[model samples]
Target chain A: MKKDLKFYRTLFISTFSLSAFTFGGGYVIVPLMRKKFVEKLKWIDEEEMINLIAISQSSPGAIAVNTSILVGYKLAGIPGALISTLGTVLPPLIILTAISFVYNQFKDNAVVNAALKGMQAGIAAVIIDVVYDLAAGIIKKKRAVSAIIMLGAFIAAFWLDINVAFIILASGAIGAAMVIYRERKRRRV
Target chain B: MIYLKLFLSFFQVGLFSIGGGYAALPLIQNQVVEINGWLTMKEFSDLITIAEMTPGPIAINSASFVGNRIGGIAGSLAATFGCVLPSFIIVLTLAYLYQRYRKLTVVQGVLEGLRPAVVALIASAGLSILTLALWGEKGISDIGSINLIAVALVALSLFVLRKWRPNPIFVILGTGAAGILIYLNI
Candidate 1:
């Protein structure tokens, strides 16, 4: 698809704004991205958007960053990926740079102390919500193996104090082994 | 030396946090708090708050926050880049390879297993933080000092999220304001 500079500019601006204004992390960006990429820009169809989300979720990294790169690559190849990533990082970098300077100054102040202390509970709750949200999605799918893995992983992580990296690696191995064994058994039957 | 350590720490964090943003939290805590001795447990919890209020992934925000604390903006850049480099390369390769072989069972199986594990990782991370929030690192020493207000706030936030599920930004901001008013007396 031959395109002009406007394509790149829009990709940059839209991604920049999305990364800037959107909060609450990766999952939050999906629908907003669809609205822009699918409905507004028509750069990608709905299925492609869904595919990007699936890929982003399955792969490592933040979903927002991953999708932005894919969308950028789709529009203009490697350079598009680079530009969109620049857009993605720019706002957060600037915002964080500014906050870093001030955080040291006001972190120990009275109001800041109370605010952070108060927010601590809320932060805990939010993390709980993340846990629930993810579990809900998996449970709704109703896969017994997935459910068992979730429970087992919780034990490994929380109780056993296993390293998270190893838990993931082990889970993936079990999951693959289960799939393979089941398939082989079915073929025999 | 600080910069190199920062890069390596975050690099390890980025490479292994397989599921999503929140999945990275435990690793972040380990590398920053346990290994590096950069921040206290309390300060680490506060960093989560700062990251929560910031406008990006918790991993990136904390990388920025931790780096700045250690070595200023230059450190921030090094840590941030280190945090993202693994993701950048992995995703690009996956995007390319996935398009070619979307049906590989190994690929599908790994993704399948990772989801539930990701859920577990997140829950584990949350409970630890909740423990810190409510009890403050001393179950035996300071059992009497549990913060009831924070507990109430946690209940309220969870209820709101479950029922309304509104924008998380508002929920966080609301708690901040409520936290100020409620915690000011304490």
Candidate 2:
């Protein structure tokens, strides 16, 4: 089970293809990654994929890229992580750069302008779908604490317009506090 | 100098962007729009739309696009590197230690706390974009700010998403075409 040159190549190529083809963000890429790495390549197992998913979700980056880094690290090492990131990132960077060149011309064109505006609406709808999907998952779990945290976050952002960083750190703090409280309660028992 | 700024600002984006890429939006708006004034609210919304349609995460695409705009190809590379560096280091380090970290009560609690918060951030990002697209930057009070065509497009797009559930790229492209037709009719 040597992770030779061929291994890194496969790591780079598979992630490249995954990032290149997948259009939507986190929700789309993570599952596809599992299929490719676990189901197809047999590079990692189901539990490993699940762990990677959780790590990627909690970590501070694009879940897509983060997952790529995990699978790459698991397979190879630091170099694997670097190569896989290049694979995942290159597609969007290349495409967006090309688009930028013609962007000014496209920006002012009537058809393009109209289409872009329409795309905004479409994008909004997509965001709605993401929201619904995530919310449904949370609700299905039926955790009162989670529900309260979710609502608190919504209000802080939507109504108060709080900075998101503070919200995240604060939420993390609250979670840490919860653990401490539970620990004390268990000791008392 | 410009490259440094591109690197630093995006480094901040990468560092603070928790719960995934969409959660980065508010922070991005703050840096690119409010702090640096690199792009307007309108432009930022457009950035999100384009990034959404593109292949990578919104944070990376936006960094590339903005960095390119401000500093050229070097800027693009710099900003992209800045955007990804934190994730690479953090995720790689965590991946190894995660087996142990997952068991810690504090770590478990933090992850749990962040989940709902992440959802809120994403939902809020969506709401902010909806607000921007529909009513411009005026905090939603003025009915006059509403663009009827954009509103119409919103309903149509939502229906398409619910009914067909096609690849999002196609839906976005279709709406853009519809946008052209609306302008043409006018």
Candidate 3:
């Protein structure tokens, strides 16, 4: 029991600290997590790390949290998952709470406004970087159909102001249809 | 009743917010602004700005802010948990199944199709944020030409920096300085 508590405590602290300071969300955190979990701690192998990213992205929730939960669970089971998730989430929660409390007071503050404006620009760039990486992966796979789906989705959302969920659902339907079509074709052949 | 609704709503977000936290934005905006009437559109916009600037996932930060707005500390906890639980359960289950079906071509084909859509979703998110930040009446009315310039410079610098590989922190700070300069000049 004591050992379990110690493990949970450690897991929680590590996850909380990592999540607290991580910036730019899922893509940025991936490499950092690879370093920490695979290289430093040797907690999981490279293949597992890749699988974790895949599963986390495909599954619901925040990718960072999902990754932590999987790693934690892998290391120490359900308790570890709980502890790590709490750890990963707690710091950001506390920090954002403090920010929220002070936001109104600083709403019109000049320096704060400037800093945010700058960060906004950086965020746009980071997002572009993410898109570029994804595009490269898709291109490498020679998945032109998927590329078209992505383009259509972007145009739909950007030009028409369609909701994202609808796009995702539509894309999923298309994917399912393609699978069924391919299977039928193969059977006929 | 209100708290229960809050919990259930965010729980739904947590459950289906696949592809990442940014993907959750439109749903979150709809729920908080249109459906729930918890926040004004402006407030929701501002919350997104705050979420972007902060650490952790945007969805979690938004949940905390929205939660706090709705019901203080307890509300925040409820919303955060609600946002997280669904994904956790779903991912865990998927992770287990993934091991067995890892090599199936049909499964691969589906994932291949999903990847591009995810990219498109993210690009749309970027465009939406850009429109909100740079093209609003308030944005134009207040800052006018200077804001447009800032947006252009930022976008251009981002493009260049992608090729050159400068530290992202530096780029952020530089754009911040640009904002301050624009403000002072105005």
Every candidate's CA RMSD = 2.3, 2.5, 3.5
DockQ values for all predictions? 0.67, 0.68, 0.53
> Of all true interface contacts, what fraction is found in model 2?
0.78
TM-score of 1: 0.91
DockQ of prediction 1: 0.67
TM-score of chain A of each: 0.88, 0.82, 0.79
Clashes of each: 0, 2, 1
Q: By descending TM-score, how would the candidates be arranged?
A: 1, 2, 3
* Residue-level error in angstroms, candidate 1, position B69: 1.7
Tens digits of lDDT, candidate 2, A11-71: 8899999999987788899999999989998889999789889889878988998988888
User: What TM-score would chain B receive for each of the candidates shown?
Assistant: 0.90, 0.89, 0.75
Instruction: Tell me the tens digit of each residue's lDDT in model 1 across A1-189.
Output: 456788788889999999898877787776888899899988898887888777777777667777788888777888998888878877776777678789788988998888777777888888898788789999999899999999999998778877677887899998899888887898999
- lDDT tens per residue, model 2, B1-186: 889998999988898788776778877876788678998777788888889777889988988899888888898899999999999888877876877656888888888788878888888878877887787667589788688887887888788888888887787888878877776788
The parts of candidate 3 lying over 4 Å away from their true place are A1-3, A38-47, A114-122, A132-144, A159-162, B21-49, B137-146, B167-169
- TM-score for each model: 0.91, 0.90, 0.84
Best by DockQ: 2
Ranking by lDDT: 2, 1, 3
